[model samples]
Target: MNLPLHPLHLKEGGHVVDFHGFALPVRFSSILEESAAVRERSGLFDISHMGHFEIRGSDVVQAVNRLISSDLERVPSNKALYGHILTEEGGVVDDIMAYRFGEERVDLIVNASNRDIDRKWIEDRLPSGVRLADHSDGHVGMALQGPMSPRVIGKILPSLVDMGRREARTLSWKGGQFLVSRTGYTGEDGWELFGPSSEGFTLYSEILESGKAAGILLPAGLGARDLLRLEAGYPLYGQELTLDVTPFDARLDFAVSRSKGAFVGKEAILDASGKPIRHEGHPALTGFFVEGRGIPRTDCPIENGSGAVVGKVTSGGYSPRVGGGFGLGFVDPAFDREFRSGVSGKVRIHGQALPISFRPWPFVTGGILRAASV
Candidate 1:
């Protein structure tokens, strides 16, 4: 897939890589530099590759409520809600954010990789009178994040500078209008903007020019984004979440609404006892920090005292903010009970079971300048 920002990335000397088939920037300078920019100052990311879909009609609200696990009853107009889509068997199809505009119109931004599966799953169950449209081709998306993000946005969209978290508002620049939401995947003060694909290049340049004087905003890419989300304890679709992993296993209970009544997979997700099942391995994704001088990688075996494999690392990296190597892995919740200060286990690194410790997934709290995406 081609990105609207590809030409700009090349002009800026970004190192591009194939991420889930789309060629995009991995970094403009260094991963550490870009990641630091978002944490301490500000950064802009091109996330145009994510899938965009919309549902509309008088009954769209009701149709959406039945499709996802979250209760949208209180999701006020011009705000967004995060939730899950499940198979009848209770496994996750995709995690999504529903942006509500009115009683009838709603836009969904889902993971880019789950484009076909998520659209098909939702459309198949869409009720009569509701309409679904894939808007991925019509728009380009960008994320502006960090403590200085609000200041940068103020220069471009002064009206949106005061917009509350999770809220959406329309803004126009250069005769091109679009939606800007106070939402983001990174654990920072950020906003996601969706506008005409034709205006993408101009928007990127404008933001750069607007914030360059203050050294607050810099172009960032996937490498920095991955680390920032991991630091925030957010789950990546293909990593912590998968078709085989339910929201329960992902520790995303806050997104599920049992009291909202029926939704897809409500039955299979709950046991006869009316609770989310832990399924095989009793796996639950949790965060961890390296005990000493070890780095963890994906698929690294997590083991107990008896050296039995209990879980595997999902995402791990050096956390520049924490000044330590950190990781996220799925482990038996029962093992979590064994924590004194932290859960000690053997993390198979480089063919050796290096001793490791498991703590809560979010290594840092309140680091995000704004409210979390969900």
Candidate 2:
């Protein structure tokens, strides 16, 4: 696997790990330490391995709008949208964040592992007068996330302080152009920056220095990023979502706009909604809190009180901020109803049954999200 680290990452002593064919930093400090830093202050992340695509031409908006579940008509120019690209059968191809640059140009940020498939998917379905171009190789992306993100980022890009969530702007600095978006995977107020790949290190260093001067920034890695997002009740691709799961099944109906007229998966989505399919033989996906010491891993079986197999865990771990282990996974919706209503169940980890209970997500509350709005 090719290791693509931002120059500043090397300088900071990033410990790189192979993640789905891309070498990414597991942590600069320890995962727990980095996680604490973000909760208390801010953190920087190098996310250049993610993919980017440009869609342009006369009918770009109309063409692009038909491709995703979000109501793109409502997404104003210079604003970003969080939604999914669905297959013809209504299953999710990938969940992406699309930024509308203008009437004729739009930018898409997709998951790293799905880059090739997503590019080809958009290219094959492009309407007349619309063209799709892959620019992931030419751009490097990074995120500044946490409660203090806006304050630190404002030092470099003051205009960012007033930008609303999902807003974006193209700014110039040192003879280079960057498309900065007030968006991030973490449930914190932050921004995602995009610019030339060759200058990734220089830009990263400058941001790091600026953050250090502010005394609220820290270098975070994938570990902290995952936990923060999960705590926010955000769903991750390949875990809470998959090509086999429709947007409706994942409780993402908000993304599907029936008034948008015809999309690729319109028929399937409409039909499925009228008579949703229930996973009779499958376990339902739900949130659970572990009562004992055990970290649930992917494919960990979940059993009901009668010891019947109900579902399997998708993502799980001890949340440093939450002080307990929690997980998200699919189980039979029948079991889900029972569990949610107080029926007890157990998560099978290492061949041992660990007691579990259904818990509401966004386990932590009253943070920067409230303050940022104020």
Candidate 3:
């Protein structure tokens, strides 16, 4: 389960751990240290474990649009779109990023854990004239993120320096074309690089060398990646998203094409939107800032002032930007409504009802976002 860049990580002193069947780095130095480097400078991550599927043929756009919640028809060439593949019951099969090459080709990046299932799902639903090919094993994925990412990449791939957000381009490298997308999960100015697995070592080494020349690049791992995404208030597949959770529950309605025609789970999503379906009540994913000293963890109960259990934590951890323990959880719709209106609540951490406050999304935004920093 080693990635093509596995040797490079070990050489950089990365501590390896089993993550979704792949032996990936958990940390190179320290989570806090690596995360700080990414925010201030640059960090590179080995994301080759993710699934890569190439879908081609004249019906590529129409075929994928029928399977995902987002409308691929609206996406222009050389752009990337994020969407979810759902079941008929509105359960999420997987969250994916689709890179459109043109009208005839689209590349899908799916979760590592759900790779097999997602491939089968797409394969079974695709009609004639659409061809699906699994290139996961033959591809290498890396993400270079932070403020200095553009500078580092500019040194190696100068053509991508000016790529706009959510844009993708395939440039010739070593007689082969590699895909580079201006997208990332860390809520920073970043780019994702994907190319032949055989070239992974060379590509990673070149980026590392460029980063070292800039005097700022760090080799980050899953630990830093998790914390960074948490700080950005972004959701992980198995954590904030799951088969039991709908796009509505995770507050990812923007990914759904509401104006589009029929799609899988469209009816179910419409029915579940704003409806109380869960046991305690329908839930909405919300961010929390723990005022107390303890860090929040998964399954911890989120309670109201009246001592009623309203929700449970899905993903929780310490964030340097938040300056304290912060988490994302699904709370009862009623409780979420109250909190959005300025009512504070409590999260029970090991029997202690610590004071908790609502924190707006994209908890830390600056580098790429030109708006007011939160």
The global C-alpha lDDT for each of the candidates, from Candidate 1 onward, is: 0.82, 0.79, 0.87
Clashing pairs in 3: none
Q: What is the lDDT of residue 87 in candidate 2?
A: 83
By lDDT, highest first, what's the ranking? 3, 1, 2
TM-score of structure candidate 3: 0.94
What lDDT tens digits, residue by residue, belong to model 1 across residues 1-374?
77888888888889999987888899999989998889888999998888888789998988888889888776888988999998887778888998888898888889988988888888889988999988787467899998899999888767788888899866686777676789998888888988778876688778877887777889999999998998888889888988887899888998888777788888878766668766775577777777777778888888887899888899988876756778888877787557424657777888877777656656666645333332
RMSD of 1: 2.5
TM-scores for all candidates: the values are 0.94, 0.93, 0.94
* Residue lDDT tens for model 3, 1-374: 88888888888899999999999999999999999999999999999999988899988898899999888899899999999999988878999999999889999999999999999999999998899988888578899999999889989888889899999888778765577899998989999988888776688789998898779899999999998987877789988898888888898877788778778888878643434234234578998889889899999999988889999999899876778988999888888988877788989998999989988777777766433232
Clashing pairs in 2: 283-310, 283-330, 283-331, 283-332, 284-330, 284-331, 284-332, 285-329, 285-330, 285-331
Identify the superior model by lDDT, candidate 1 or candidate 3.
3
Which lDDT value does model 2 have at 138? 52
RMSD per candidate (Å) reads 2.5, 3.0, 2.5
Better candidate number, 1 or 2, judged by lDDT:
1
